[model samples]
Target: MGLRGRWYRGGTSKCWLFDSKDVALHAPTREEIPALLSAAFGAADARQLDGVGGGTSTTSKAAVIWATPDADADLDYLFAQVGIGDPTVELGSNCGNCATAIALFAVQTGIVAAEDGMTKVRMRHITSGAVLSGTVPTPGGHIPKSGLARVPGSNAAGVPVNLSFHGPWGQNTGALLPTGNAVDQLQVNGRTLRATMVDAGAPAVLIPAEEAGVDLSSMADNLSGSLPTLIAARASAGLAMGLRNPEDPPQNAVPKVGVVAPAGDYIAADGTTISADSHDVRVRMLSMLAPHPAIGLTSAVAVALAASVQSSVVADAAGQAPLPGTGAPRMLRVGTPAGVIITEIISDEKGMVSEVALHRAARHIATADIDVAQAAELSA
Candidate 1:
């Protein structure tokens, strides 16, 4: 058996996208699906040298897409984080970067017809039940490969995919502040640190870098040596969020850990200089316990939401003023190791977040097939 899928560059991430119908026909069972994906990505290999994986947490992902019959949605999208060293595929959350590419994949694959100018693909995440809309450029019933939109960390210019996350709160843990508090004091490695755990697009644990005893300038250089402490903090915060128990190990993906600080100069992963004045806040996030080369899309959304709340640690670190009581959209420029991700958050009259909008660029890379037998046998 073979599965037909397409490879796409979704913002800074890449994924193999399969139509749900095809998935149902070929790899139907959950256990079999992971085996197939692992085979395609060559999992259990840290480098993923023999597979399509780009050898990083960001690139080791997959998506199952389907056109929804529901009148309210145009398509349904499910994201998977394919583990590299472990034979696991987690479907606990959606990937914002991959969400951008899904709109293009749907239109190009004929699941949704492309309109003349901008095509709006209303997407629903199966895991979180959260809704979002992605606006894609279709000049002539086809997405053009060339555009003026430049996404940081992407080498080529591509069509700008504007994504709006609707009702982004509580997508993971059933509460915006999972612990029912804006901030919690957690004991990590015998030291108590105050942290904010928010569940907007994804559950996240935000802590001030200074409180973590990490200097922003040397944070990257020290990340490897400091991972144990950071992981302990995240694990403790996860307990507070109710994502795990005292005896259960922490969920590696959810409640992402981020060390934040006021805007500061830092060298990006590509060796480019990011001036402190270019952004409002500086953040370094970890996915699966490894430092993310860039901020994850869902994590970025959480950061934006956290910044909108005056009492949240993210707002305090960004030096954001208290949100106005009026209903207005606030903009935040988040500086990451890759570059800057700008997010606009809208709040109701009562200062409750209603929507979040962010822009990213994506490109359709290749359409190909993987032999199920080959993929399944690769590990054996």
Candidate 2:
């Protein structure tokens, strides 16, 4: 039998969306899920030439949505990171970019009724128990394709979809400071480097690019040489964050690694110049061991949280710019290789991170069916 799926461009990332019912029909047991996803994505091949995967980590994601019993949430969204060069699928984390597209999928698939103007869809991530609210513009019961919101890596303009991650701290590792310290001296490759491991929207290890002997402005230029060090640092930090153990092989998706530095002149992926004065901090986050073309939404949230802390590496890289007035939310502009992404961070009376919000755009790309037999044969 064929499984129904939809392709969506959510922010800078793309993913394949499937109804939970359809997924259950295909893979009845959890053990079979990885094989099923690998077959569908044409894994075990670096290029992913036989499947829909775009041959990159950012495009090799999948999401399954289903109705939930909780009254606060309209549906449950499960995100899966499908491997391209290996036959592995990691469901330990959530994809903030794909989370924004779930709202549109719910409305288009009749899981939720869409009203005129903007519709708010509540989602619960099954893996981390994190709740996110996605506000999508639905004019006349149809998602509008045009709007003012523009993401850094995408070429098209669309309505700004506002996503608010509620209670985002400790979504995966169970503690905001998973290592119990704002900063830790990590021993990597015979040298100790200052690192901050924070769990906000996601668990991320932030390290200074200079400490690693890499140029932040030209991260992509040295990605091949720097990945080994970054991956080693990530694995070590993952163990400290309690996301991995010495007995278990490192899962490259979780506890993302970000190399940070003060804003500087850099060349964007589009060949445009990003002025140092335009952005507060420069960052390059990795997805599945490769430098992401753009920053992930959840990573941006983690960066905002890390930057607010006084002694963290991200804060030091951001310099002494004052955050917004205490009572209101503040927008922090983050510079990535693609461009600048604006993230809003709010703090409580106790000065702890209260909420993080950002704007993303989603577009309905295509609706299709996957032949399970064909996928399985390709894997074989």
Candidate 3:
């Protein structure tokens, strides 16, 4: 079986997208979705040399998208993390990056008509129930595919898609602080680590680098020396935050786990020097099992919102300071390996995050009919 798919460069990742209708008609039941998608992406092979999977967590992703009739939301985005070398898919988390991609794709496919100036597409994540509004610049009422906006991570030129998450607090776990504490003591790797478990954009655990006992100074070192520890921490944190059961397998996605450090000068992946004064917090996160080149957009939202809560690990380390005169409703500069991603988080009188804005870029690469073999045939 094959399905019509569109390839898109969203934020810092590449994703293949399909219509929910086609997926419902073509794909099998929920239990067999992993197998079906795996065969399609050639995930059974680690390299994915025979299929479209990019052999990495950031690239080996697909989503089922559709328009919704709900007055509040114009589109629905269901994100899927297609496994790498494993025949499985994770549907438990929301992806701000993919949501950005789907917003532009909606304009391209006429799901939402393009307005003369900046068009707004209200997107709701079916996975985690997070609501996001994306602003797609449609100059002259034309499709905004060709763009000049640039973010920290990718070099690809794409339409500037600004995503604003509305009322994202309690999105995944029904509360801003999932553990009901600004700081929690978590046990992992036979050591006690202090962490802040937040659930604004998604369920996330932010651990200080000192407690995690890993050096987040270098990107390469963060990947090689810190992956195992972070993975273990993710498993332990997930269990502690009630995101996982004692019997279920470890989740590869949420709760988004990351290691945080003070705003320190570091060399970026592109060999550029990032000054400490330029950003608030330095963060290194795991995409799946490896260090993400840049933090995920949802995770960035989590960090930014988490910083708003006093005594949270993110707040302790981030300091919530950006350069002078760089104003939004409120903002924080997150220093990633790629460079800096500024996250704008707005708070209500109650100090809960009411809205968040993340800058991203997306470009539709191509549209094609993807051929997919039976999972059983491939496994055999």
Candidate 4:
């Protein structure tokens, strides 16, 4: 009768759910889906007065699913990153947080059989066609509702979600260095910037914190209200890094920016105190065209990738984490606006990262049925 779905907050993201059998997507056009997505997740207001966006890009998302089409993969998941402050939905991107939600969703829906300790799930992303192998903590052969691992934010400890992606270097485009160079020198707004451009979980621009005139050594509290400048810098950096039209780019898009400086102390937006002595580098990231008070899981991985590779721009920024060999996962601890996120990326002998893993604790708020009238209309 209507679009039946559930809602759950995974890490820093929230998603609207749908079962594929109940709804057949027939390659629907944008006009058919954009309006429904906008209404469900707000596009005009910062607070998303219309629905549940929470005024943050990472929090606004939609997930369309179906039974596994491949016998090898456990479930089929289509993740759409809905722009929080805009009316556009990019179906070509994957959300690490949402991906985590999908695994739990599969287990909850019984689409995936819970295993003893770790439940391995093979997920085929509808957008990039990349396959990701995810392992979750499933105690008693059931998805555990609690765990000892704690993520930087959300303050909720539940099951742990670890995902490793294969062939992610060229996720959207066709090369690790989208422009055929790890570092590119570009001019933006009359400023010269040397950048490392790479495609991992998503597209991103890695910038030296000092070059951007951002003193990462000081606490973020000392740089209060400077987010606008940082955002402008990130936008400029994104443009130089060969992003598709850095100005007025896709709403809530990737190729996020990361500014790094030598380690130092800082206060998080959540009021949590952090000392830089405990971290290798002081990092700040922007999500969806704006500087987020916290960092996204995928963004962190991209930073780790940049850090691993030695370049003119990132040469001195990264610590002494050995480059991973084939089938070996790189352990990366990124200091973000919130606190820290540990990223593990598996790479082959040729320095190609096969998969990425992010382990964090989150709360299982609630899952329920609701009617999405517009989504139903689009299907028709």
lDDT to native, each model: 0.82, 0.83, 0.83, 0.65
Candidate 4 lDDT by residue in tens digits, 320-374 = 4447566766666667777866777677797766666777544456554434435
Give one digit per residue, the lDDT tens place, for model 1 in 48-67.
Answer: 76667777888999998879
Candidate 2: lDDT over CA atoms? Answer: 0.83
Sequence-dependent TM-score of model 3: 0.95
Clashing pairs in 1: none
**Pairwise lDDT winner, candidates 3 and 4:** 3
TM-score of each: 0.94, 0.94, 0.95, 0.84
How far residue 80's Cα lies from its native spot in candidate 3, in Å, is: 0.4
Candidates ranked by lDDT: 2, 3, 1, 4
User: What global local distance difference test value does model 4 have?
Assistant: 0.65
Between candidates 1 and 3, the TM-score winner: 3
Looking at model 3, residue 113 earns an lDDT score of 90
TM-score of 1: 0.94
78: Cα error in model 2, Å: 1.1
| Cα deviation of 208, candidate 4, in Å | 1.1
